[model samples]
Target: MQSVTLSLFRFGPLRARLWALSQMATARFALRAIPDIGTVKLCGSGVGEGFTPVPDTSVYAILATWPDHNAGRRAMFGTRVFRRYAEMADETLTIFLTPASARGRWDGQTPFTPQDITLDGPVAALTRATVRLRSAGRFWKQEPAISRAIGKDPNVLFKVGIGELPLVRQATFSIWPDTQTMAAFARADGPHADAIREVREGKLFREDLYARFRVDAVEGTWGGVMPDLTRRPTSMTNQMKVAAE
Candidate 1:
């Protein structure tokens, strides 16, 4: 079976670099039009007004499903559609993952199918939620501090926030070297734990879905330049408002 890939792009923060979601509709349309494309989504980040206070207008992302590895690679690395996004941003990062377990629905259907993996490697996680209007404030209240904690945690390989709607619908995608490390960051003492508790107690979201996957590859660049994916970005300080829309 062909593996799935999730390509991310974070552009440089320049006033001239700002581009709204509406303007990119054509690009999103073009990608879906690709014959091999499966489940594809375009999202905005919440580093600004939506959730996290600190943000960058330049950052945006792409999540895609393909028929196979070759199909994904052909579109992302070779197609004109992908090139336009890369050229517009000052920085961009993309990673590919193989699903290990997926449950629940996304837009009514499960977009990712779990696949058996017989290898030892890194792990990736995705959390999606539809926030209830009444609880939106409380949910966002915990984001800034938690985001900072994740950004500072050495165990985290990389993570990003992306969503269909600013605060009402949100999702996070993160990678960890191992499950132990991932749990360490999400455990009792941290901001993550606090947020988890509030959600359970307060019923913050009307719906949610989470999944784990096996790492396939972490490649590509950000800001017109490629950086080492094995380690944190050299300019990590600027990414403080790292959550998505």
Candidate 2:
């Protein structure tokens, strides 16, 4: 079973500490060196948007698509580069997901193939965009409003903004209780709808991609707390135990 892992790291409160982590730019090179990884993207957050920029000065994340569980586990624990990351970060939360429907290109390729997932629990979604310079101001303006809307939505389980470039390239990773509820939030009259309309009308993005997945397991805490809608809990313990060994 191919698996996608989104791991977020919170370094600490010092600006210098956050700046020091920029060394990750060089370390990410090691991820590409892994044979079992199908695709991997090193990401940070945007300014006002969570998907702001990297060397984020506080937090950073990795979105990796693996061939299977064993491959991901081996790399997470066995790799020196990855071990250094864990050693530095104050807290790390890694979530595991299996794709149900993926319908876009990520860096010119589809990293995940849509699967026949039928899970009735929390569903995760990832939306990424490469905004054109001309439309960037408009895109940034709409983000905070859209983010507020998402925060207010009751169905939201967990969400984060992550990106490669500080402002121009951005992505959002969020989860909901189910597909229907997730769709409903998008349909509701809010900044989300407004942003969509504006994005199309303004030609906001040079490229954009969206995908939904079945949340098979979440193996860590985001802030000493698991996602609110999590349906399975043991996955974290099992994965942690393996890492500890």
Candidate 3:
């Protein structure tokens, strides 16, 4: 089973923050050498509303794919690269997912392999794009409104704006109770909808990807507490295990 893991690390002290920042470039080497690892990205989050020109600097993410659940778990919990980030961060959270549907590419490579099974409960959506140089200004101009809209969106169970590069390359990951609620937000009349139209007409991105996933399980804490998983099925709930801190 193809699995994807998004590991978030939140740093507290200046030293830890700096180390996290430096690893955005330095850690890739270690990640590439890891066994069973597939596509990987070292991402930084946007400041405040979470879609901005400025980065938060304190929060970072490692998005990786694995051959199966066991391999993903081993890498996240056992590898030196992951353990180092965990040790340095004040808080950490990792979510495991199985792709339900996916299209497009990231950095010219398709990262997720979709499963044929239907998803019934909590769903997660990941969208990534590399803004064309000429379209950067136009792309970012929509950010304030889109960020505000998403921040105020009540249907979103969880959301974060993270990217490999600030400004030019960005991605947003959000969880919803179901696919219907998630699609409503995307189709609704708003800044996000407006931006979607503009992107299509303008051909704003050099590369882009959109994927929907079934939330297999999640471990650890985000913002100092675990995300409520009561909405997920008992089968997935049974799979949840808090990773050693």
Which predicted model would earn the best lDDT?
3
Consecutive 10-residue window with the lowest summed lDDT within model 3: 236-245
| Backbone atom clashes (below 3 Å) for every candidate | 13, 9, 0
User: Comparing 1 and 2 by TM-score, which wins?
Assistant: 2
lDDT of 2 by residue, 1-245 (tens): 77888887777857535553565577667888887887888876543433443335676788898876556767777898677777887877877788888776877888887777686889999999898998777777767788778777777888888888767878998888888998998887878889888988888888888998887666556777765555766666477456546
Model 1 lowest lDDT segment of ten: 236-245
Cand. 1 Cα-lDDT: 0.69
Model 2 residue runs over 4 Å out of place are: 13-20, 46-56, 233-245
User: Better model by TM-score, 2 or 3?
Assistant: 3
Q: State the lDDT of candidate 1 residue by residue for 1-65, as single tens digits.
A: 64677766666555424554444566677887887888887777766322453344666778888
Q: Name the runs in model 3 displaced over 4 angstroms.
A: 48-50, 233-245
lDDT of each: 0.69, 0.76, 0.87
Residues 1-245, candidate 3: write the lDDT tens digits: 89899999999999999999889879999999999999999999987454577888889999999987778887877899999999999999988888999899988888899988677888999988999999999988887999899889888888889988888988999898888999998999999999999999999999899999988778789877999743556465345333222
Ranking of all predicted structures according to lDDT, beginning with the best and ending with the worst: 3, 2, 1
Give the winner by TM-score.
3
Error of 1 at 147 (Å): 1.8
Model 1: CA > 4 A from native? 12-16, 48-55, 223-245
